[model samples]
Target: MAKVAVLGAGSWGTALSIVLADNQHEVRLWTHRTEQAKKINQTRRNDQYLDAVIPEAITAYSDLKQAIAGVTAVVFVVPTKAIREVARQVDPLISPETTIIHASKGIEPVTLKRVSQMIGEELTAFKEEEIVVLSGPSHAEEVALRQPTTVTVSSVDPDRARLTQDLFINESFRVYTSPDVLGIELGGALKNIIALGAGISDGLGYGDNAKAALMTRGLAEIARLGTSLGANPLSFLGLPGVGDLIVTCTSVHSRNWRAGNLLGKGNKLEDVLEQMGMVVEGVRTVKAAYQFAKEQQVEMPITEGIYQVLFEGKQPKDVVGQLMSRNKRQEMDDLAQLLMERYSQ
Candidate 1:
């Protein structure tokens, strides 16, 4: 019965808190908003973000230090934009021995740093190998309902990864361990870009054929970039890779997909964001990825197209046409090039 602190009061954080509580761990769910914390404690529910009741073993706290005190593990479930601030706050309060785990998935725009990288940058007390990432195709809504969901945990240290796996695994929520931290994080982050593209395709009334093509080619693009960044190419075919892409692109629960759908239906980016009232991670990730790909000289036409539509004022239909009109190439060129590079490395 370890004491765990889950930062952020969003759906994912709350659901994960429920999981810990269910497993007989004492859970401290921290939200920045005092009202939210009080409400959850009073009603045992987080009505705004989650539909299910929070467990009795889970306690909500607005004080960051109080929530983290004596906890053996601290799970970060905040947004990418908020990670640094939260980490800075946590650095002074948390013990160096507390295991750090982050479940957020997105790349920082200017820095192009993954969520784990951002946390590591802020929390100097812990070694890089101590950081763990929890990611996969699981959605908070379904997980809250105790529906079967599987996810992967990865770290530079195999022991740390397995420790994190043990912290979250159960019959309904299966956890797997992997050594390819770079591949897992990259796959989880980059898949959102493709999900947005998929939503746009659907919103534009494109049939199954177009979406299927987009998903397949999007996986190729993700694998291409992941391999360039020292990730194992085969990891792209796993749960955090192809599995995540499929779910985010196809599910209505995806904020990124919903945002892209609105854009495809002719809404402006600002209006779409305002209407959604949630952080559509894909929007920011597309921008960061566009710059990163340019720097690395990687080919990512689908991501480029989405970037243009979201930031450059290009019409969604026009971007689609541009993508289709690109010069033809062999299907396996990307894979072959990546494999050659991998072997040479």
Candidate 2:
């Protein structure tokens, strides 16, 4: 088994450390807080993020240098907002040969860069080909419970992508390799916006019909934007795209959905975020996505609605009414046109 360093000790990071340990890999889980790392090392239980008993092979580290010492691979599961800061620190410590894997899902709000792009900008020690992205529908909570979970690893380097697949695959955890890194990143990041919409629909007393419409249409918009940016449109139809969309929009463990639910229940945005106590990526992604969609000339009504509700103080009911009252077009015709346009290129 190889030694792996997982940066970030949040729920997702903690859960991923558990998976690495289960696979017999020595894992150094890093958190900035010395007390938390010491506590995790002593207790073997990260009660704040997960209740699962951590395996003995997994140790927590407060020092970044110590955590990354001589590791074969480094998995970054930090929030999108923190990706740059973490990558800067890791840049000097990371070996050029070390495979950098990021599981965080979100676009940088100000720059509109994907997680991989941000890491690429900061981690000059690593080549772009050395970066891999692990993304799909697998929630941290269920994965920690040893539930059956599957994800896709994508990279410009096919060999490295396959290596990432091998690193994470096990009996309960299935991994696939893909060359469409942009699609994987876009799908994983954009789906959180739809998940928030789904939660908002639920919180507003809307039925499944509302959520289903929101999810599917929201997906169409995301695909449109992703394709415009040179991502494989078909990639979105697979794990990172449709699969992640389903899980995030429907799953109870989605923090983005929970945040939206609180917003729909008339809580202030600040209050919703404060109550979540987790990085609701959708909140930040919506801002960047909204700006990007406009720049790309892609029509994303669902994203716009969520953006307005969160940032413009538009009520949930008002947005829903506006969405329903919009001029109509054939759904299949639009989808077919998009597919044709993408495939023709």
Candidate 3:
């Protein structure tokens, strides 16, 4: 069995460690906090993040070098903001043969880089194609419970993607592979923006019709931008795209959706964040995507509306009104444009 280091102690990281341990791999679950490491080792549980017990094959470590030493792969499950800092710390410690896999989903606010891109920028020891991304509709809470779930692994290198898929696949957890790294990352990141909008819609007491429309149009916006950035439009139809959108936008387990729900219920962003006590990735992704959309000249009214509500202090109901009252257009226009752009290249 391969030795794997999961560089984060959050729910997702812990859940993935459990999966690795179940698969008979040696797992090192690294947390920056020494107290957390001690607690996990003593209690065999990560009470703060996960409800399930950690497996015996999984060990917790506070030392970054020790956790990664001689490991075959390192999985990054940290927040988007922490990716670069962690990468920098791990760069000098990891061997060149170590496979890097990141499951964090969000774009860098200023650079608009995906998590893989951000990691690549910080870790010069590894090539860009060696970094694989693991993402889909699976939630940490459910995965921790050993619930049936499916996810996709994507990389520019086909062999690397397949290797990652093999590392994570099991009867309970199915893993698919894709070569459209750009599309996979974009789909995973951009869906959070729409999930926030969906939450806001629900909080405003809107019915299913409103959410349905938001999800559909939100996907269009995602494809528009993803295709513009050299991604395959068809990838947006896959697990990381539409599948992820449905789960994040509809589930109460979604931090982004919960944050937006609080905003729609008339709570301020600061208060919402304080209550949640976790990073709401959608808030940051909305800012990054809104700016990126403008730079790319892509139309993303829903994202723009969410940005206004979150940043410009626009009322959620008023934003919904603005969206519905916009000038009418053919429903298939976006798909047609996406098709033309994708095939023309």
Candidate 4:
């Protein structure tokens, strides 16, 4: 057991805190909101975000310094938009040897950088071996209740990846390690876009065939962009990519999917966001993905369609029709061509 600091009191943060405490590790959770910290400390519960279960061994702190002090590792579970801010606040307090793991999944909209890169930019004092990313199909709601889950922790250093794997792996929550940090992080971030597309399909009352098609094609777009950015293409077929997509796109727990569902049902994006009350990552990700696709010259029809619906007032039904009416192509055409090019290299 190790002393761990969870720098965020959101649903995912609380869920991860529960896991740490359940595994008999001492966990100090940090939040900017004093009232929220007080509530968690006094009642051992996080009602607004994760109301199902709370671990007694976990404590909440409003002071970032106190939360980060003397911890063996820091696990970041904050919103992607706030990661840099939080990193700035926590850097001075982090020990040089402390292992860092981030569970948040989303790219920085303005920077178009993954959370790990943002963390690196903020914490210039830490070496690359000290950072890792933990992501996969696990959702905070399900994990907080101790339901079975699995996730991946990827870092450039294989030893560091294994250490991360050991930290979170349990009978109920499994962990896998990978050295493909860029690929894993990129896959995790981009899958949310596809989940949004999946939600749109659901909202349109489209059948499983439609949803499956969105998921499959959406992955191709994700892989294409990631590979263009120097990420390993094979990582797309692994847990952080396809496995996470299956859960996010198909599961009701995904906020991105839910947001898309509302859009498909004729609700405006603004209205859906207002109703969610929490961060809907896919909305933020759409603009970043759009910019990334254009910059990388990647073809992402599903993402493009969703972007139009959200920003250009395109009808979701019309977008669906446009997709179905596109030029016919072979099933393995893209994959085979991509592999052939790789072999030529």
Candidate 5:
């Protein structure tokens, strides 16, 4: 069996470590906190992050070198912001042959780089094809409970993605592969922004109709921006796209959606983030997407509206009005607009 290192011990990280352990692989699950690692090793209970018991095959470590040594693969589940630092620390510990997989979903606000890109930049020894992105609608809580879940892996090298597929796929966790790395990353990262919007809509007491419209149109904006960046528009239609959007927007497990729900209920951005006690990626994602939209001249009214609420201190109610008051567009099906001839390239 292949040995793997899973960085970060948060909900997502712990869940993925469980997947690896269940697959019977020797998993080195690393956390930055020494006390947490000791607790995990002693009790097999990552109580703060995952409610499920970590399998015996998985070992927790606070040392980066000990966790990565001789591992054939490394799974990065850290927050987007910590990706660079962790990757840099792991770079000297693992060989160039160690395949890198990242499930951290978000774009860097400064460089607007996807998590894989950040890893690639920091782990200068690993080539672009070595990086694989795993994303879909699966929630950490569900996955930890061994609930049936599906996710997709993407890379520049289809073979590499397929290899990752074999490592994680099991009866409870199904894995798929896609060639559209750009689209996969875009869909995964941006859906959190839409989910935040969905939460805001729910927070405002806008019934299903309002949320329906928001989700539908929010998808349009995602496809629009994704296609402009040269990602296959069809990727937005797959697991990484609409599948992810639906789960994150609708599920209570989604931190982004929950954060938006708090914002919708009149909490300030700082207050919402502080109260959640976990990283709300969509808050940062919206800002990056908004900046990218402006730079690319793409129309992302929903993202723009959310950005205003989160950063500009605009009221959620007022942003809703602004979104509704925007100029008209053709009522054509979003499918037509998203998959138009121009995006075929």
Candidate 6:
């Protein structure tokens, strides 16, 4: 078993640490809050983040250097906005041989950078090849209880990608590997926008037909942007893409969809955010994605409509009407065009 360092004491981080510990791997779980670290280390519980008993094999620490001093891999489970700061703190403690698997999803608001790019900016020692992204439909709440969940581990390097798959796969949890790091990362980040749209539809009392269309067309937009930036088109249909989108959009566990539901119910954005008490990634991601699409000249009507409703105060009903009235074209025209262009290169 490998000695793994799980940075961040959030629910996802705590959940992943438990999984590694249950797999007989030594885990050094680090948290920014000393109280959280002390609580986990002493009581074997993280009451604030996860409502479950922590594993005995998992050791918790507040210090960055000591937590990562001699570990085989470092798993980043921090919030998307805090990724760069957390990576900066852990950079000095890492070695070239150590594998870094980042699990945070969502793009940075200011830089509009993917989490992997943020990590790249923070860590100067390794290239993008050294990084791996762990993402899929698995939620922290269910995973903490060891419920059956499947996820994907994506990297530019084939060996590193497969190694991550082997590290996390088990009977209750399955792992798949992919070389489309960009597609995996992009899909994981972008799907939250569609989930927000899905939630809005739910809030509006729209039926499954509307939600299904939003997801299908929403995925096409994501594929368009991803392919423009060197991602595999097929990856959008896989775990980190469609799989992640389905769960996030439909599950009541999704904070993004829930927030959008409230917005559709006519609650102000600030009020909804204050009530949740947790970060809702889709709200932030919509702004970044909308801007990215414009800058890249990629057509993303669904994302554009969602952005207007969230930030520009467009009525949810009006946005829906606009989407339904748009010009229709062949379902696979854009995808086919992008794929053929990619293949010719």
Residue-level lDDT tens digits of model 3 in 233-290: 8889899999999999999999988988888899998899999988888889999999
Model 4: lDDT equals 0.87
To one decimal, what is the Cα RMSD in angstroms of model 6 from the true structure?
Answer: 1.8
Each prediction's TM-score against the native? 0.97, 0.98, 0.98, 0.96, 0.97, 0.95
lDDT of 5 by residue, 229-331 (tens): 8988889989999999999999999999999999998888888888999999998899899999999998888999999898888999999889888888785
**Between candidates 1 and 4, the lDDT winner:** 1
lDDT of each: 0.92, 0.91, 0.92, 0.87, 0.90, 0.89
Kindly list the per-residue Cα lDDT of model 6 for residues 264-305, writing each as its tens digit. Answer: 898889999999888898888988999899888999999999
Q: Ten consecutive residues with minimal summed lDDT in candidate 5?
A: 331-340
Question: How many residue-pair clashes does candidate 1 contain?
Answer: 0
Model 2 Cα shift for residue 302 (angstroms): 0.7
Assess candidate 4 and give its TM-score to the true structure. 0.96
RMSD per prediction, one decimal? 1.3, 1.1, 1.2, 1.5, 1.3, 1.8
Q: What is candidate 2's lDDT per residue for 1-345, written digit by digit as tens? A: 989999999999998898899899999999998999999999998888877898999999999999999999999999988999999998899778898899999999878999988899999887666689999989889999999999999999988898888888998889999999988999999999999999999889899998999988988888888988988888888998999999998878999888888888889999999888878999999999999999999889999999999999999999999999999888875455778876798
Best of the two (2, 6) by lDDT: 2
Model 6 residue runs over 4 Å out of place are 336-345
Whose lDDT is higher: candidate 1's or candidate 2's? 1
The reply for model 5, stretches above 4 Å from the true place, is 333-335, 342-345
Q: After superposition, how far is residue 54 of candidate 5 from its true place, in Å?
A: 1.0
How does model 3 score by TM-score? 0.98
Better of 3 and 6 by TM-score: 3
